[model samples]
Target chain A: MSKNEETEKSDVKDSTAAFEEALAKTKDKKYVLHLYVAGMGPKSIQAIDNIKRIFDEYLPGKYQLEVIDIYQNPVFAREGQIVAAPTLIKELPPPLRKLIGSMSDTERVLLGMDLISKPNENDEKQQE
Target chain B: MIEEKDRTLKEKSLEKAPTGINGLDDITYGGLPKGRTTLVYGSAGSGKTLMAMEFLVKGAQKYGEPGVFMAFEETAEDLAENFASLGFDLDGMESRDRLLVDHVHIDKSEIEETGEYDLEGLFIRLGLAIDSIGAKRVALDTLEVLFSGFQNEAILRSELRRLFRWLKDRGVTAIVTGERGEASLTRYGLEEYVADCVILLDNRMEEQISTRRLRIIKYRGSKHGTNEYPFLIEEDGISVLPITSLSLEHEVSTERISTGISRLDTMLGGQGYYRGTTVLVSGTAGTGKTSFAAQFCKAACERGERCLYFAFEESPDQITRNMKSIGIKLQPYLDSGLMQIHASRPMAYGLEMHLMGMRKILDTFNPDVIVIDPITNLISAGTEIDVKLMLTRLIDYLKLKNITAICTSLVQRESTEGINAQEISSLMDTWINLRFFESNNERNRGISVVKARGMAHSNQIREYMLTNHGIEIRDVYLGPSGGLLMGSSRDIQEAKETAEIAAQSKNAARRKRELESKLKSLDAQITALNSEFEVQKEELDKLSSEEALRSNALAKDRSEMARIRRADLH
Candidate 1:
């Protein structure tokens, strides 16, 4: 029984190592995001929570999110060209993209970042 | 809800923040409300930015209050250059920590709004500036640029309300300038938010004359002037004119001043015009209205009192040249700075604007007397009501300050006979009408005092004569038929009267000579008669002597009988 338990523990450790290696490899494609917000109004808090949820569910531990309150850090706000609060900026990506509004529409946010494909009708329009 | 709070706050405090603008303090009683926001809205080039800048600069310099100017449209350097001519120490004040200027460079194309946001960054910046300088006043030169750049207007509105409230809480008087709207007071209708006070500025052109007008639309819990006041943006800054006093409670004087021509002075109330009264010199063209006014100005200047001559039809050099012909030495006064001759065409500005310019001159020069050479020239610039209203206000203000004014009005030749004094009677405290009377194929000048409010003036028409010395008023010459005569007819009548006097004196001399001759002849006749009688008496005496000798013997006897008869007769 001790040998079998040791074998199980070793298998679990191997699986954890494999998972770490996979995470490290996926980190190369990680998303670096900044959510600029005014104080925590309903929409600002919602946007922060929504973007966090989308990143956690889709990319797991591959994304780094920095939340900045414009009221507290106005310098950052000015330097980032953040005119409105609850703004999401994909900072590290070569094609930097900005998403404005409450993050209620996950599909649209993904489409703005080119993370998703539209339905068949969009493809037909592109072909034309 | 904001209005209610503003009203309550105003009533509780009754505090004021003085704006060191010319004549604006008097109109606002003290100034804008203390620790409250004022909305200043105006069209382009209406001096809005200049006015706001002046407010801040003056606040720091004169009121002992530091100010912060946050401009969204103009850069700090641009502002500094714009106000350099006004001689404001903007850079000095900024260096001394009394003034802080922030320019928010905004480009609409560059701005990208993504979500809900407040203008908290601006608030923080303004707060930091205020905190650094311990500012007591704050001004946002223009908010239109922000509006144009920002996409979420709802957020901006909320932020504006919050910002104003924050300013109130910060205990700083604030001025927020905005672009004018088509129908509303401000482009964004922000007047509804800043409810403490709203001032509207307008720049309009009438007949190629540009006039800048300022009017206070709302001043909660305070009584303010409702009329549009004229303001000037000059080298010294914005100067608002106090043309009309809201009240008629001005002190009046009973003192008098000469009208320059001693004869005309005598005709005016037997003394002259009241020292602080307004006189209207109305006449037909070429009847010497300007000459009349020039004489007054000369007399006033000669009295060691300052005088201002505003000539509309002639240039200053022209006026001086023309006046020199009448023995009025205006150049000396000009050199001595006692007399200011400001010559501008009546079409240079609107009537009210002219009054404002006059008011500014009045304040700067502080002249004891003012002469408007031909106030009628302003008629071509505005309606009669406009001219009359401006004149009324001008006169009213002059009277309030105890400054004498002499205004000339030209009447059309075919208008009326005696005087067109009824046209502006309400505005004139004294009216002197000058007319050109045609008599015996010659034109003669006449002056008659139509009205003198507080004193009795001459009712007879005196002929006005302008010579190398000055004006001279002559009494009328009465012809043989009791007809009033002037010009060559007057000379003719005087000659006739002289001839008649000579003829009468000659006749009296002839009659006296005749009477003396007749007396001498009668004396001769009496002497001759006396001689004849004497001769007769001598003959009788000789005869009587002969008879006496013959009767000498009989006399003794007759004497006895005569003695007895005499004794009986005794």
Candidate 2:
């Protein structure tokens, strides 16, 4: 990765450790997430499935997920400032984060949600 | 499928949506394309966002077409606050369901792109906003911000193309603004997507002065003005000036108005300037150009017509006071609301601002006559071409409205004969040239008509005075040196002419008396000669009688001998 990404990685590493310590002290820390999608498209389905599976494996009943279809509830799109469909917004856990595209990349999702600090091999591919 | 047939059937005639901005519709032949996307790209602070918003606001307010403004840069509250000063009630429009504003905030630092995605959420929000208000017009102010929010260029590009097609399919006229690029029309090449029409706004600085210009780069299925027109952004809105009225086909009126001075009127074809014509009064410094314009303004007001005066060099108080010195009382007309005076320094703003301000005044005042005193001061605001272009459009507009206009120009003393107000002189209908006559060690003012279209005007240069009463045009006076005389020199010439007439009459009377005396002497001498002839005749007659008597006595003696002589005679 470039210099900025490396520095950002080190910063994320420092913050992730502090967040994990707080989570351990609480022992009941919950993640609040809102996924905005358009109707029943394939990307929306894939995103819903991928995020649910990750939450089950890691969060394990310690999270709340609201799947909003902008086609039916278009008002949420404006409120969430969503341009691309299948966008995941972590509204809880202090610092807010927005992840665009389907939740197909688990490492990026975890990094975006502050679950992990280190980036996967995908960072090298992006740099190339 | 039915819409495809409908479009094909009406492809020959493209309908338009009239942008209520001043002077923009005239150059666009009407306005922007209806149910089409127009790409407006410009550099930073070039007024692209303002122009697009004005288009939407004017459409909603004037055309009764509800609009949706999807701002990608400024927030909804900020946009409303910024436009509040321009008299646009955005908050009120939203309440009345006439307009809708949706700000799409996207921060690059907060976004993390992972995998495949499509911009379907934007379409949903935009569709919801439009359907809520039945909006016919939409504005996407700087949509290129989405490029930074999303990392995939291919997805962004395809999504933009789909968005424009979607806007067209919905039959909503849209304006998409983009930041100007170095080698292309937009930073992200947005022009390639929204290709139905494109407009470019530019703000250029020359000689430490800034001017805003707008040009239509392309307009499909329509003809538009190709020149870069100067535009102004005032407290109200943007106004583009369509310079160079394309034709000389404006209608002419036969009505005549007085020039306030009867002698000057007589010199100008025994009437005055035409009712809806432009009169150029050109002269050097202190040659009475302003005074001449004031006289015309007074005349226009005397006929119960409203007159607007634009003074570039003098203040309203100064003009009124100076005019009072020449017996023109403008205070009453001002109080009665028949006259208005707008005075400002020529360098107070750019030439476009001046023109736009004057246009606004013309709208509010609706004066029948306008006077621009000393247009030479405007030269400091811009170049010669700029001034000329501005004046041409101004004169053309005034004529079209049937408003009589008088423009005064100041020329240099040495170059007045050749220059004569430079390029602006040819655009005038009647050109009155005031000059200074330097002779006999004194300077005086003389006035003449250089050219007066459609009238018989005087060719003689008459000396005019700004006396205590008003302007007075004197008769042509020829000096002894065979040139036009003025001032004290004219007075001296008049006196000398009067003395010459008296001397010629006196000499003729003297010769007549001398001839009368000679006739009396000749008559007396003829009488004396006649008396002498009669006396000599009487003496001769008396002598002849005496000789006759003596001859008779001798005949008596000779009678006796005559008898014998008589017999020989028989």
Candidate 3:
């Protein structure tokens, strides 16, 4: 387990160093979140994977994610009074938010998590 | 799994969960309504939580049904430790997956309530726990404080309502405890919302002594006792004395046991007290209340049945020492484990406490007969109503158990009255009153049957002496009037009666001799009159013959007519 930790730590160091090189190229906002699930069921795992894939593709090392299983540590959900899981609690970028239900829906999850906004049809028409 | 008969018995389209407390099941006919929440509201220290916890623990252990306990007031560890004295190993049950203790912590300081929230988290956690163990019973201990302390009242009430409905839908027997309200069942007055059954617990102090009482306020579809039953919360958990609500369906016994004294037994309808009946030995001081009670205990022990003697006025040693003088050896019975003497001052505890203590001993010792010496002194602990209620409950319990009980009460020596005229007597099946009869300037013990139900007991008040042979029934001598005679007066009266009877017989003999002489003289006079009648007949015969001869001589001469006439006359 210690070796695994060491390898993961070195991998994080490499990713951070590369991200620093790329961050000098573009400007983006950091994303911080906490995801609560019932247990490591297939749906929960899928939700975790979907969110992680989205984060990796869009935010890269700019985001921090913490996943908690309500089955194992229900205290978080109890303390937060979270109604449902897989719930994504956004605790960054000024306003706290909650995105409940399946996280597999990327567009809805992004919109609900304040990652994206609906485009205005009139503005698009005016642009065209 | 439900049995066929039980399902048919409660065939009200609703399942029932049995709470395995003694006498409790009998009152509920089984237990609380199943698959629904039961509201158990009570004041502080009323054993509401204990009742709920016992329901869960007993359901898990005895009925083979797993349970989940959601304790809101006390933490899981503290609850576990508190219930450990009841011999419930919560940790063990948890390890077995038969129980789950979830402590829902709701500290307002640690909470950040910013937006709309629900106990959806609680529902989720509780649902998951119940599913994990396949639980059948659920207990939410002290839920009132948690909800009232929550920031949002509407959310709390709505969520609690939803929680109860969810539990009902999930098919779990749930118990929800609440703090007693001044004018309502629960502090929130939410009793009208959910729950198929409601029970109320009361812990009150009367005259500086405390008592715990339980009552079943409502059961939706079942028959239940409505009496305020006395309950005790000890190391063994909560025990409700539902026996007070028995329906007189207890079977009676025709068997009669002795009263250690043969004479006393004879006085009790030629046999003794009826088995399973309550007998009251009411008397004044020095009227041998304890002595008579000891005789009964000894008799019970002699039959190899356990007897419990509650001596409120005398210590067990003192009773033993005092009874030994009356030839009642209680030590032997105590040694043989057939007798137990529980002595406590009546002033030491209230009437309810005394009742619970007796009930506690009743359960532990399982005595066949119980003797309570001087129950009158318990009057000091409570009102007359309280004492009467306490004794009625106790007697009801004993009768329901088919346990014969003897109770002694001390009245004023001069008055020799009851606690209430005919109050205790009417409640008892037999009432024997002993009084000190002052005769010839000496006090004598006289016992009489005030009332013995369904039996013909002697109405004569017999003066008895308590010697080393116990109580001896002496033949009562009636005084010149109607009073009972005893002591030297009785001896003197007996001797005088003998002398009077002898003198009266002698006078009767002399009168009989004089009447016989009078009869002899009358018979002699009748015999003399018979002899004179015989002599007169013979003289008449001689006179008639001489006249006939003279008439015949005259007839031969001048006038034979006279002779013929005389001959004709002859």
Q: Tell me the interface RMSD of every candidate, in Å.
A: 3.9, 0.8, 7.6
DockQ of 3: 0.07
Alpha carbon lDDT of residue A123, candidate 3? 100
- Of all true interface contacts, what fraction is found in model 3? 0.10
Q: B503-536, model 1: which lDDT tens digit per residue?
A: 9999999999999999999999999999999999
Candidate that would win on lDDT: 2
Could you list the CA RMSD of all candidates, in the order they appear?
11.1, 6.2, 12.8
Better of 2 and 3 by DockQ: 2
Candidate 2 chain B — worst ten consecutive residues by lDDT sum? Answer: B413-422
Which 10-residue span in candidate 2 chain A carries the lowest summed lDDT? A22-31
lDDT of 2 at B551: 89
DockQ winner between 1 and 2, please give it: 2
Instruction: Estimate the overall C-alpha local distance difference test score of candidate 2.
Output: 0.88
Tell how far residue B303 is off in model 1, in angstroms. Answer: 4.0
lDDT of 2 by residue, B212-249 (tens): 89999999999999999988899988888888534668
TM-score of each: 0.79, 0.90, 0.72
Q: What class would a CAPRI assessor give candidate 2's docking?
A: medium
